[model samples]
Target: MPSLNKILLFLSSALATAISVLVLGFSMSIQWVETTMDCTSSGSSFSNGSAVVTLSLFDGTMTRIHCPFFGGQDDFEVFPQLAGIGGTPLVLHGLVVCVLVLCLLFSACSILISLYNSVSNPYETYMGPIGVYVCSSLSASFSVVVLLIFAVNVNNV
Candidate 1:
């Protein structure tokens, strides 16, 4: 039964890690859409779009979470003043890259630890489950941070 427990633990940990990645990736993609989508015209009005976007989060039926930053009044308008011409700030892209790197790091670490535990139990101490739980939690926490940052960026937009 311990072996079964270990397998279950590993599987659930894997699932959780996958979920975390999915959540972060989805949020990132949503941000990208907001950054690139044409929102200046031919869409809902600013106030209506903002309200709908905010409500989308609670709808529970939509897979995509829209934000006011995308097409509403905010529209994440950015410009690179130092570059002479106008464009999105380099710092914005840098932040997104940083978040992606962190997510990848945590996901890779979780998978690696799980694989190592399954392959070699040198001490037979059964640290696999404990390790898995910790890794999963860490990844989940990082995911939350990504989500919060997304919200912040949206508002700034």
Candidate 2:
């Protein structure tokens, strides 16, 4: 039978790996940020409707949901504004995605190391407890990086 420590390591690593995958999926598919504004009461004759902006953090894309924005009758005019945003917020969003990717990778490493170490002769060095701890800590560190970058991106955007 496997040792209690081995079993615990295997279970914790497995759970971390699964959670990482689900979070990555959500990051890619779900809308990360959204803002809606009512321009009708802006004391301007031309501004008559609301505007909505949605952001996809994973891809650094900003989408304008409302057409003919600011009471402009031509819908295609706003198309140019829908292009990928540039500058600090864009860089910040990219950083968030990259950190999350790193987090997922480290989580996978931890799970593999746990399985291998538990099943075989656990190495006294990196392949043993050291490997699992390093991978888990790196994963956690990347998660914190992602949060900080995302917060900066949202604030700047």
Candidate 3:
């Protein structure tokens, strides 16, 4: 049987990988939306209208739809200024994703190593547990930071 420590380490690593994947999915989705009012050019008889605007972080695009109760629908696309406004957040998010992938890979390796150690030399000491702890912690921290950045930046947008 594998040691209790090894079993715990494997579970922790698996949990970390699952959490990282979940956060990555959220970070890649459209994160913000806003509505605004617009007026028509009918002189004194101007009509009120509303527009729905959405910002997608992964695609770096702003989509707008003019949905007026009295007129035909109009769609507008504003090219995302990736380097202008979203540069910092995008870079941070990308870095977090890379770290998460690395952590997942490391965790898988650790699990394999643990299994090997258990079967081949059940009495010997191995570094798999230490690696699992380190990778899990690092990935969790990165995920939290990425979430905070997303929340703040999305709110601002």
- Top-TM-score candidate index: 2
Instruction: Please count the clashing residue pairs in each candidate, in the order shown.
Output: 0, 0, 0
Most accurate candidate by lDDT? 2
Question: What TM-score does prediction 3 earn?
Answer: 0.52
- Tens digits of per-residue lDDT for model 1, 45-98: 553222222211111111222543442232222233213432343354345557
**Residue pairs whose backbone atoms clash in candidate 3:** none
How accurate locally is residue 82 in candidate 1, as Cα lDDT from 0 to 100?
A: 16
Clashing residue pairs in candidate 1, if any? none
Better of 1 and 3 by lDDT: 3
**With candidate 3 superimposed using the best TM-score fit, by how many Å does residue 142's alpha carbon deviate from the native?**
1.2
lDDT of 2: 0.65
Give model 2's clash tally.
Answer: 0
TM-score of each predicted structure versus truth? 0.51, 0.68, 0.52
